[model samples]
Target chain A: MATETTQVNVLTAEDVLKNWQGHRRVTRRTIEAFPEDKLFQFSVGGMRPFSEMAWEFIRMAVPIVDGVTTGKWEEYKGSKPETKSELLRLWDVQTAALDEKFWKIPPHRFSEVDKAFGQWEMPGQATIQYAIDNEIHHRGQGYVYLRALGIAPPHFWERD
Target chain B: MATETTQVNVLTAEDVLKNWQGHRRVTRRTIEAFPEDKLFQFSVGGMRPFSEMAWEFIRMAVPIVDGVTTGKWEEYKGSKPETKSELLRLWDVQTAALDEKFWKIPPHRFSEVDKAFGQWEMPGQATIQYAIDNEIHHRGQGYVYLRALGIAPPHFWERD
Candidate 1:
């Protein structure tokens, strides 16, 4: 008797993208929950304001995709948005860009190692995972900030 | 002309375990950085003390592993530790248990969808990802609490 072995892909490229976007949706809700004044000025225990952290997410996200796909690493030259509305506008634009550019990645490239932005060296997919992880980490800080401000954050589990 | 294609496994079960353990290492250092008095009693913006949040991580992590592997869900029945030392002791023990039990999972099981704790329904691997994401989330809150107490947290990226 002979036996055959087969391999299964645990996560597909589309699945990874959807997971990242689900997290983005929850984070967008976190931004919406913030009071306008506190979005840029609030800090607890000396952490930066939530707006600054959100800017960090924006800086790394789509640009990372561009780097992974095109091997073109462009430093973010955009000015920071001073108000909540402007911030949301940029966020929406980048969200669309992420959806569009992410598909351009060849599926085989996900497992290929690359030095993202000539800095962190990891699998292309891991770099993308880092972006998602970083957002969740900061959003947790935003939740703390929201509670301190006496506002409830968007539910952590309700990523959709 | 003929063409052949192959599937690539982007992340293995061992890789997932290592990633989770790396995050746990960073979270452990965070627990070590807290002032002993503030671990259980400190709060910012009305969040729970860092120790309470740590307990939430402990309650969910290894038990989720057991539930996934054995299809037997056990509610955490242990009493909360009163001091940081006791807390770390339990953390270390559970950390060891996680390594041992994670291997018991059949590889195909990673993609099998089940309702974790009879509540959240997703692939077994995703349930594990949620555990890691939740820890990162709470640790961000811990970082805020530490800063408010005039303490510095461990570097966020140095998981090792």
Candidate 2:
């Protein structure tokens, strides 16, 4: 059978930038919904704690993005804060930087490959994409934890 | 500051069944790796083409489940087809039945809802969570479509 590959239209750097920005907005809102007490909760003994997952969310982004652009696991020199509020503040700052800087990415750069987590070889675009998608994935777990604790997270229906 | 009021989770019974079934390994294998022509090519626009939105694997399951449980829709009531030659034929049949059955779901029964879809009046779960997460959700879309097209998807790196 002749296969039809659905090519995602080549989006402008600006469009991709907007998409990342939109993801950030939703992420921040999700952060705002969390109560402090449950920050470290993990649904199972084996899974990453929510607090740890939140930190993982932070650690994963810069190195992943750096890997894509630089093609190596660059030393991530950013300071890790001690509290969730500080983490959230740093998150907002870094994501804002992404929104502002992501548009400057050249279109020809999509094929650039980089090492993620200092181990895996992945595309630069994949790193950034993982940054966005990973949050949605884990934030999902956050919802499960929230429900278990009787704290409702934001509704998925309404958009900011 | 206007605190964002928590939102409700509104999903039809149809949404629930499709989501659960869509995540099945057999279903994932069938939908994600179908021929691109068959997988990406579909009859709708604005809506994801079947091949592209492998994430929508849940579409067929939701409506069929809803119809069977609620007795409200007629979309899934046709005589079952007997033979299957191509990769997507079974996938198509199941999805179509579910879609038809979705229309049959009664409005009043939405309160009872599916475990996966949750309820329509609470801020407890996200529609996208129920819509995407409970089903194939994140890793399912292009990944499975690629598989359906005979390209192997990336292995779960964390999995041993």
Candidate 3:
């Protein structure tokens, strides 16, 4: 009888983080592509302005990482930025925070089930993936908004 | 000396398929949410109507699967379906074809770099991931369209 084997470790923790950051880079470009005024004001088809969507990403992203690492869920209660520069500044800060805290999570924790923010219950990996997927979803909306405004959004495939 | 062991097989082939199909189900609902007249004509901010985006997905998705399985790349050149029912029928058919061809791909091939359609070059897994991500991206636009039309889109989180 022949023995069968499964391929393991197709992706590493580092790979996951880098993949997410790649998407983040593209999202940052999406932010920059917007006219400062339109970033907060322009919306399509009753969708929230891109800035509001961006705030959603900011609120969920680093907080989720923090919750995953420290097992302390703190709801983000920060005020929305009134300017694109302010928003970008906060985005940069959280991006740094995300990198710092993401490393503190042990490899084992990613597979363990936990309730993020004491609400959504899922494995840690799914929680992280949801954050990424949500960003991509909103970014798509941003793209439509940009096109409507006669601006071309960043290329979706240029994640890096 | 202590040895460090890496976790392997965190996700299996089946998990990947189920994840993609879950997104597909939500996208299918997005199709159903549209009024028949608006399904092909509605637009937001100069973006393509939902039907056109759906055609883009149909063009890229299963053909990529076929290319992955057979190592033959043929561009999808079928004409767009004019009616929403015709469109949904094609969507369902492709969904079945996707499942059928997805499994024919060997696990090892997923990690190999190949140019899908002789253009984009990446690992087979990334290619497939792009297809799913692209769907989510366009579906986000569909959500905005639905809301603009005073129709509620499907719950994005209800991917199961």
Which prediction has the highest lDDT against the true structure? 1
TM-score for chain B of each model, two decimals: 0.92, 0.36, 0.92
Error of 3 at B31 (Å): 0.6
Per-residue accuracy of model 1 over B67-153 as CA lDDT, tens digit each: 777777788888999998999999999899887778777666677888898898988878888899999999988988888889888
Model 2 clash tally, residue pairs? 19
- Residue ranges of candidate 2 with Cα displaced over 4 Å: A1-5, A8-12, A157-159, B1-57, B60-160
Q: Rank the candidates by TM-score, best first.
A: 1, 3, 2
Alpha-carbon lDDT of model 3: 0.81
Tens-digit lDDT track of model 2 for A1-160: 1011111122233433444555556656666666765575534323455676667777776665545544556665777666668878888877866654444444444445556666666555545645655665566555555554567667644444
The positional error of residue B145 in candidate 2, measured at the CA in angstroms, is: 26
| Winner of 1 and 3 under DockQ | 1
lDDT string for model 2 (B1-160, tens) is 1111111121223333333343444344545444555554532212244443333433535543453345333333343322223335656555565455444444343333333333333211123233433333334333433433446654433321
DockQ of 3: 0.37
Candidate scoring better on TM-score of 1 and 2: 1
* CA RMSD per model (angstroms): 3.8, 14.3, 3.2
- Pitting candidate 2 against candidate 3, the one with the higher lDDT is 3
Q: Name the 10 consecutive residues with the lowest summed lDDT in model 3 chain A.
A: A1-10
DockQ winner: 1
Better of 1 and 3 by TM-score: 1
